[model samples]
Target: MGLEKFGKCLSMAAWMSLLVVYAYAEGSSRKWRNEVLKQVNSKGPYIGLITVFPPEETAFFGTGAFKPSPIHSSLDLSGRRFRIGKVHDKKVIYVRCGVGMVNAAAATQQMVDLFEIVGIIHFGIAGNINASMSIGDITIPKQFAHTGIWDWVNQNGTLDSNDTVAHLDFETYNVPKGGHNILGQIRYIHEEFFSVSGEPNIARPLFWLEVNQEWLHVATKLERMELEQCINKSLCLPKKPKLVVGLRGTTANIFVDNAAYRDFLFHSFHVASTDMESAAVVMTSVSNGIPVIVIRGLSDKAGGQSGQNAIKTFGPLAARNAAKAVLQFLKQLN
Candidate 1:
């Protein structure tokens, strides 16, 4: 054979060998992942049931109809607990994700990583920002955006005239120039999420991470399902609590108690509810390519009321209502 032919043969043989090794590695990785999922799903698919605080979880584990599950707690590595049990004869792994965005996101990531959860159902109490909605009403937002991410733009910056940027001016607070945590203006920014795709996806900064649409469609069954109007005999709400779905929701680390900020969220994003943890949970689940949905009962007006926050009085009741809705959702989830 000519020298060129010999070299070509050698190159072809090396390329073929490389392809075989690559194929075997890819197959093994895929098979291993499949085995992990299969092992977790051996008996049944365990649904991830997550709540924020004690009140939110109390509805499920502390209340009458919903007794404590025979929990098999795990995920000890993160110093968090994941309770495994059967609810309505369905497999569930319940965990309290704690109070803020960090806690919620971390717990959710841990839940997905530790166990092969089929999907996530995050329930909690949230402040109602929609004027039309009332306390005791439950909201199942189609998607949640982490509105907390921001860019504190100086007054001299270009955002003043930039209509594209959703900037919240701190001028209304009247905190004065030298006051603590004073700001000129803040620009809202989208949180960038990592992609499973091998191709570059840097331009995609995600603002709203949505729940599974098919799951949302199943939630339509919950609309007609009746909800409790009052927690007790004397503490009835002004109107019967309604189920409003496909609405917008927002989340932030800050516990919102100001009507102005509440109004800004409503006006800017048309959010029906706002909470501290829902967006983080949703973001983590969606980023992991896991299906997730949020159910939040309105405990208080997101500081829209003139008096003190209504959550103090109605928090438990709202959490209970949300828990009830979560149960109903689970029934329909199958």
Candidate 2:
């Protein structure tokens, strides 16, 4: 009987110990989160600039032909390097957010949570959805949407009596109802395995974040400024690239190289450009109530004859144009 009582007491003590550990962990987590929040919100109203990778990063803020200045560096919680400096006399923090939606979203969230950023600007090369838009042309999207989220419906066994479907079959979730900008309204359908680890495979909302109107005005004005037409004498272009603003843009994980898909997205979303990161950045910005804009230079027409080859050949030129436009916009901000 004494042994039995001792065993019960030991179990209770163990349970209590576990409770203490759990409480400590919870408290530590909350404290850490609060500290991060404090740090991010305490910083000055700095602009956040994001590029997909190193080349684009080099184009925007690196020590290359368009030498800007010595950029200050810091590491975020994720160990991603952030370059802090003044662009056109305006305070800015630039980061290469890697490539694709996941990287973009994570980096954006870190920027929002760890810095007092007033707005976000994403400058990178993108595949042009608008046939009229040529390589090296800069595009400032009015809004951004996630083209990757889709709903797949099986209609193989749901045929009509006459073996012909009466209504449209296999409908896709292109644009979320009531528009994609409304938070919590847009639902995403995804395969179970495709869901991010630790995140449930539940319906997620698609966000169509709009660029700030004031920023858009500034961007529009920058169009009148002289832009670089050539990277060098040997790399001269056939025509001087122009800045096109107020067009729609979309983002997805896939690098679209199919003409049919490109045309479909262009017509369906009324978008002029497609990239792998812009929409995710926009969504994160909108969720945090910060204004954001995407400045994309066309490295290639989506599924053009040159295809992905154009990205390598004209990518640096396009990135330079984008950087020029961004600088012009920053100057206007000042």
Give TM-scores for every candidate, taking all chains together and pairing residue i with residue i: 0.81, 0.72
Per-candidate local distance difference test? 0.81, 0.74
Model 1: per-residue Cα lDDT at residue 131: 87
Please write out the lDDT profile of model 2 over residues 1-334, one tens digit for every residue: 6999999999999999999999999899878757754653455578988889877877776533232234324544566877666666676777889989999999998887777799999888999889788888999989887767744334333332332211222233335533222121222332222123235545343346577787888888877666567767888778878899899998889898777678777776678999999978877776667888889889887785543557888888888888878887877784
Error of 2 at 12 (Å): 25
Scored by lDDT, the top model is: 1
Q: Which ten residues in a row have the lowest lDDT in candidate 1?
A: 67-76
Residue 311 in candidate 2, Cα distance off native in Å = 0.5
lDDT of 1 by residue, 1-334 (tens): 9999999999999999999999999899778756654555564568899998888877777644343343233433356766766667668888998999999999998888767688999998999999889999889999888888887876556563432337787766665654433467888888877755424555466788898788888888898767777768988888888888899899999888888899998989888999999988887887778889999999998788988998978998889888888888888766
